[model samples]
Target: MGGSPHTLCVPAGCSSSDDYTVPDALCGVTVGSEPLAPLLPDGEKSVCSVSVDKKQAVYVTDGVTDAETDPVAVQRDALARMGNPQKAAVGDDARIADQGGVAVGVCTYQGRRQKFVTLVDLTSNHPVPKRTADRRKALESFLRAYLPKAMEAKGCRK
Candidate 1:
């Protein structure tokens, strides 16, 4: 596997038992057994991009406000479910409300075999109902295209 130039040390006070690191400036880490390339956007520098090193994937945070957005909550809940499948039923309402409104991606690291979830905010100027619908559609499209590959690469089912 290829070595990643960036290392993300776990911050103090985190209760996770896994020792994970990510590239500098990335918000998430990847996991797998193969060499993973950093996901970069064309012609962009540090504003919007995602990168994954062996066994670790990193996503740059966009800092979109989520306090008033059900989609954000739905996305978070879904990721949590990925970590614990049993929790899927708990956030169904939020999930349905935010349907097609959230964006998600995954990356893998060959070193630790861990997958990280990446969420992108897609705020809409349309009315609340329309915005939510649009967001859900966009997110669903992204997941359909990229998620299966990521799951296969990471050896995860969800």
Candidate 2:
């Protein structure tokens, strides 16, 4: 988008004739002149125009997506892959935690299997650990049920 006009300011109390032409990089683009062509219409084509401010507000670029590496789905998948639930702990994998922060956590069982969960915290810094024995079992069951659904919702799993 075109920017605002460049101004050449004279020294304090100095006349315009005494002002120096600032470097092009320092001075902004001139205003009220014809805008560069791609922005303008060519030939008989009807052109629709929006102001720079309005254009900025209306337009945006598309984002990229990945299936296996979607943070939340990956975490759930990783946890399911690990198999054991008792050994799971928060912030276990430096790489995943670094990428997703507390949005990821690991759950290990009997030190044999591990599972990861993502987006367990919408805002909190830590996942709420299952404390009691029965609660842990319940939590594990909940993860098994919910993880697949969460992955599917993110379009990361079939």
Candidate 3:
């Protein structure tokens, strides 16, 4: 948390200069590629980093060079797309919009601080479809493979 946030573009020798270590493992988990593959454009790999502090944590990933949106902003926009209501449940107090990219989850851990926000944002270079039904379905499929391990890595609990 002491250092500035940095982005890394893998295979291009980009470095993550932030205080946090990039959780590259998020990209290589056993999740089926079918759900995530189409969401990404051509010739991009799923790379990710975790930027975390005491009260919040964000795990963002994409197939491109850098994240185009902040996790909080992505969360807000995706939620707004759902008419600003807390919909869809993925265990814990998590809400995932049906538009296919951002999820907000509340994690509880035993400490002076009892809760924190764990945001998962899957940014894409390609524009999302206007209908979003297909994208939403794909996102849910991808999260089934990505979310549990990501939360564990973030030291979050349901």
lDDT of each: 0.30, 0.27, 0.42
For candidate 2, which ten residues in a row score worst on lDDT? Answer: 55-64
Tens digit per residue, CA lDDT, model 1, 117-138: 3343322222112344443443
lDDT of candidate 2 vs native?
Answer: 0.27
Which 10-residue span in candidate 1 carries the lowest summed lDDT?
85-94
Off by over 4 Å in 1: 1-108, 127-131, 148-158
lDDT of 2 by residue, 1-158 (tens): 12322234333422533222221110121221221221221122111221222221111011113322344443455434323333333333211221112123233333323333333211112212212343334333333333444333333322
Candidate 1 to truth, TM: 0.28
TM-score head-to-head 1 vs 3, winner: 3
Query: Higher lDDT: candidate 1 or 3?
Result: 3
Question: Can you give the TM-score per candidate against the true fold?
Answer: 0.28, 0.24, 0.46
Model 3: how far residue 11 lies from native, Å: 16
How large an RMSD does model 1 have?
16.1
lDDT for predicted candidate 1 compared with the true structure: 0.30
Residue 29 lDDT (model 1): 27
